[model samples]
Target: MNETELASYWNNNAPAWIELSRAGYDIYRDYLNTPAFFTILPDVKGLKGIDIGCGEGHNTRLLATKGAIVDAIDISSLFIESAIKMEKEYPLGIRYTVASATKLPFNNDSFDFATSFMCLMDLPDQEQAVSEAYRVLKPGGFFQFSIEHPCFKTPYQRKVENAQGDIAFEVGNYFKSANGTIEEWIFGDAPDELKNRLPKFRIPNFHRTLSWWINTLISVGFSIELLHEPYPDEEAVLNKPKLKAAREISYFLQVRCRK
Candidate 1:
């Protein structure tokens, strides 16, 4: 699908997404990913930053709370609209915009930092997005981002007991460049009547190899700073036994690159 179609798909899912995120029901972002991301994120106090693909703006709010002046952008108009309304309630100095990640609307060297949390792989034009991220950052600026681990998050991935009876993540089609895999986000807090009436919360994702990501950023003049494969922390696994799978096999990779 084209960029416009992809943006519309996110627009359609925005309402449910905003509700889920605000309620703190988004397990991945709320419970796991955000904490993991902050562990590696550098101090951003007083830094000018842009959060590419900011979605409903939970992370953007977090950035503002951490003292970064943020301009958060997403391709979906509905998502940006919801985020703007949220800004009124909290009154953080965050500017929300509806714009494509691949073609960021910003001046060169305008930001001290750039970020994309679990967003890069979902874009059709990841190369362009990475380039734009590189372009918008000032010299010595850092871009920090995360994505589903390329080695583990395959097109049709699974987990099973190995010969050793230990849980093994079975990966598939890691080398293929592909897209349109459905990512479902169920809003458990929704009313029963609304559940039946509303459509499934589905979004498309693109998959690429680990090397592709590193090379793309390098080609765009980013020097790799940190590579993190974040697993469930001890507290997380203690709270949720199923999180052991993540401890054994990393579900996401966070990286910091300097431009």
Candidate 2:
């Protein structure tokens, strides 16, 4: 899909996403992605940063609370609108815009740093987004991003149960790159019945290999500073019970690079 088509896809799903995250993080983000990303997040006190694909501005607010002057943008106008409404109710000094991740509307070297939280993989043209991220940061600035681990987040998955009923996850299509929409998305905090009744949240996502991601960053003249493939901590496993597969295998990968 082209940019407008892609934007429409997310725009259509924004309300449901807002509902899912109205109170706080739904379980998937709260447990899986958030921990991994924040573990590698740099101190941004008194800094200027831009969050690409800042969906509904949750993480943008978090950055503001951490003392970063944040300019956040998203492709979906609905998401941007929701974020604006949120800012009015509880101000955190974040400026939200409706913009594409591949093409930010900021001037060159406009920010001290750049960030993308699990957004690059969803973008149809990830290279352009990385290039734009490189363009917006001042020399020596960093771009930190998180993604669904390409090597581990499989398109086809199955659970294998042992004789004692212990379960393990098996996966397929790890190397095949594809784009398609899931029939629906299930938030961790939502009741299964409620999820079934809602329209399927549709968006296109591209899957690429780990090599492709690292090579793209280097090709865009960014030096890798840190990389992390985060798994659930023990306490999370004990509390959540069903997330043991996440503990054994990585679900999210973080990459921080400097221009």
Candidate 3:
């Protein structure tokens, strides 16, 4: 899909995004609370930070609470509206804007730090977004990002099957590069009985090798500082058996870089 189409797609699903987040908050809590995510910036007490693709401004609020001057931006007007509502309900003093990641409405070296969570892969022009991130961040400023692991979460992989009436996951190709047309699923809040009744919506998400991400960061003049593949906490593992197995293998990758 083109840029306009991609924006519209996410805008249409904004309500679903909010519902899914509320329903599966714990599934994401660990990753969001990981040391790699929140502990990296020791001097953010008074620094300027920007959260690109800041859906609903959750992480943006976190940064503000840490004493950073936070600016949040997203392409979806619906998301920006939700974020503004959140700001009004629980003021974080964060600035919100409806803008594209590839063309940030900020000046050079405008922020001391920038972050994008689970957003880069979904963008149509990732390279341009990377460049924009680099442009807005001050020298020595950090730009951290998190995304679905290309290796394990790509379209060719991720499957479910019924084996002798018992539901089991059927793994698919992992090493293969993401090419040609593919269907990307977006999960939402739905009871198990109603899951199948819900439509399978598709989005265009590009999968890139880890090396590709490293090179892209370098090309944008950012040096990679840390890379993490987070595992579920022990409590979560014990409570969710299937997820325990998946966590043993891992699913998402988070990276921190400096401009």
**TM-score ranking from best to worst?**
2, 1, 3
Instruction: Report the C-alpha lDDT of model 2 over 1-259, residue by residue, as the tens digit.
Output: 6889888888988888888776443765777677678778888899999999999988888889889999999999999999999999999899999999888999999998999888888888999999999999999889999998887776776768789867777778878876654435556557777687666577677888899899999999999999998777789878766667676677788899999
- The models' CA-based lDDT, in order, is 0.86, 0.84, 0.75
Q: Between 1 and 2, whose TM-score is larger?
A: 2
Mind sharing the TM-score for model 3? 0.85
RMSD of each: 2.7, 1.8, 3.4
CA lDDT for candidate 3? 0.75
Error of 1 at 47 (Å): 0.8
Among these predicted structures, which one has the highest lDDT?
1
Task: Summing lDDT over every window of 10 consecutive residues in candidate 3, give the lowest-scoring window.
Answer: 25-34
Count of clashes, each model: 0, 0, 0
Residue 39, candidate 3: C-alpha displacement in angstroms: 4.4
| Per-residue accuracy of model 3 over 1-259 as CA lDDT, tens digit each | 5768777877876776676665663345434333447765556889999999998777788889889999999988998999999899999899999999999999999999998878888876788999999999999899988887776675565445456534334445555545324364455324555456444445567767767778988987888899877776677656644445444455678888998
Candidate 2 lowest-lDDT run of ten: 180-189
**For residues 1-259, could you state the per-residue lDDT of candidate 1 as single tens digits?**
6899899889888877776567655666666778889878999999999999999888989999999999999999998898899899879999999999988889999999999998888889899999999999999999999998998898878778768757877788999877767777575545577667667688788999999988998998999999998777788767755566777788889999999
Better of 2 and 3 by TM-score: 2
lDDT of 1: 0.86
Candidate 2 error regions (>4 Å): 23-25, 163-165, 180-183
